[model samples]
Target chain A: DVKVTQSSRYLVKRTGEKVFLECVQDMDHENMFWYRQDPGLGLRLIYFSYDVKMKEKGDIPEGYSVSREKKERFSLILESASTNQTSMYLCASSPVAGKRTNEKLFFGSGTQLSVL
Target chain B: DQQVKQNSPSLSVQEGRISILNCDYTNSMFDYFLWYKKYPAEGPTFLISISSIKDKNEDGRFTVFLNKSAKHLSLHIVPSQPGDSAVYFCAAKRADTGTASKLTFGTGTRLQVTL
Candidate 1:
């Protein structure tokens, strides 16, 4: 079985603070993604990394940045946390690139971040 | 614009009854569709999927039906149980030229099954 682990299951941060969410996958997948899920808004992509040091912006990348310094780890950075930034963050990885067609995603248990 | 939409926000059903969750997409270029189930505080898990070439797929008590002309798909769970209560999300992927494998997700529908 594939295992994707997130560092924190729950976090509380103050406004204007910097926050980091870490994720690691044991499956050696090539693609990693960060998404924020909200009620009535669905899961909107924040950022994705296809390879080490390569990143792309997803639909809603504002105020969010990602780092992929190694193949097994991906990190999501909140430049300056705000109350509106509170959300459930999810990390997922897939083995191949043709995810639009031929791959299945393995997801890590989400981190619920609260910004006060 | 929202490419995928789940109009129903919630559904309530009795145990042992059938529960149907619906999803619709406006993008005709999407060739693959997937269903995911999520519990509170947990990430979404892949449940079932179907390609545009086929119209239906079934596994155990769950079934997925697709209608290309209507650009709609639905998930059916028979003999629904209380444990089946959760949020269901539908996603679509268009395998066109440069879109990569990124999936577009829809707003979820919360389902609660009672005794």
Candidate 2:
């Protein structure tokens, strides 16, 4: 079984504050992703890292950034938290595609961020 | 544009009945499809998947049927139980896009099972 752990399940921050959401996966997958889920909009990708120090912007990358200093850990950073940034954030990891197994994401429990 | 769409926002079914959740995609390039189940306060879990080459894939009580011509797929759960209640999301991906490619997801459908 794969375990993806989020550092915090719930977090609260004031407007203009810096916030960080951390994720760690035990399986050492090469690809890591960050996504935000909103009602009626579903899950939108924020950022993803294919390898250490390599990152790419996803559909909703504004106001957010990510870090992948190590294979097992990926971190999402909010430069300046705002009320609108409050939402559930999810982290997922998967092996490089084209392997014998199909591409399937293993996700963390998710962190609910509240910006006041 | 929303490449993948789960038209039904919600569905209700009774225990021991069959629940069918539908999803459609506009991109013909999508060669692989997946279904995920998400519980409140938790991340979505991979349920089942079907490739474009196959029409149906079954696992336990869950079965996914795909129609390549229509670019649509449906997940059917038989003998639905209370534990089956959750938000179901349909996702699609292009296999040739490589490892860094992300899956396009639909808005999701909330399924409720009542006894």
Candidate 3:
């Protein structure tokens, strides 16, 4: 079974503080993604990495950045946290694109971040 | 521009009854659709999927029906159980595209099953 692990389950930060959410996958998948889930708004993509050192912006990427230094790890960075940034963060991984078998994503438990 | 939409924000059903959740998409280019179930504080999990080539797909008590002409799809859960209560999200993707092939998701619908 594939395992996607998140570094933190709950985090509290003050306004304007820097925050980092880490994710690691053991399946050696090539595609990793970051998403934020908010009430009524649902889950919106923040950023995604297709390969080491490669990154792409999603629907709502403002005030957020991502890092992919190695294949197993992907990190989401909040430039300066704000109260509005408080939400649940999810990380997912999938096999390399273009393969029909790689359609589904395996997700981590998620990180709940609170910005006060 | 929201490509995918789940108009209904919430639905309530009794256990052992049928629960129907609907989704619609405006993008005609999407050929693949998926449903995901999520519990509070947990990541969404893959529930079921349907390809444009087929109108219906079923797995156990869950079934998905797609209408290509209407650009609409629905997920039906028969004999619903209380444990099935959660938020359901509908997603669509263009199977032929590679660069921007990420799935576009709907806002989601919360379902409650009571005894």
Candidate with top TM-score is 2
Model 2 lDDT per residue over B13-86, tens place: 99999999999999998988999999998899999999899999999999999999998899999989999999
- Put down candidate 2 lDDT per residue, A3-111, tens digits, no spaces: 9999999999999999999999999799999999989999899999999999999989999989999999999999999999999999999988766444799889999
Of candidate 1 chain A, the 10-residue stretch with the lowest lDDT total is: A95-104
Interface RMSD of each: 2.0, 1.2, 1.9
- TM-scores of all candidate predictions against the true structure: 0.95, 0.97, 0.95
TM-score of 1: 0.95
**Candidate 2 clash total?**
0
User: What is candidate 2's TM-score against the reference?
Assistant: 0.97
Candidate 3 versus truth, CA RMSD in Å, comes to 1.5
Say which prediction, candidate 2 or candidate 3, comes out ahead on TM-score: 2
Question: Model 2 segments beyond 4 Å from truth?
Answer: none
Each model's lDDT comes to 0.90, 0.93, 0.91
Off by over 4 Å in 1: A98-101, B97-100
- List clash counts for every candidate, in order: 1, 0, 0
Q: Name every residue pair that clashes in candidate 2.
A: none
Model 3 chain A scores worst on lDDT over the 10 consecutive residues at: A97-106
The docking category that best describes candidate 3 is: medium
Q: How far off is residue B24 in model 1, in Å? A: 0.5
Candidate 1 displacement at residue A34 in angstroms: 0.2
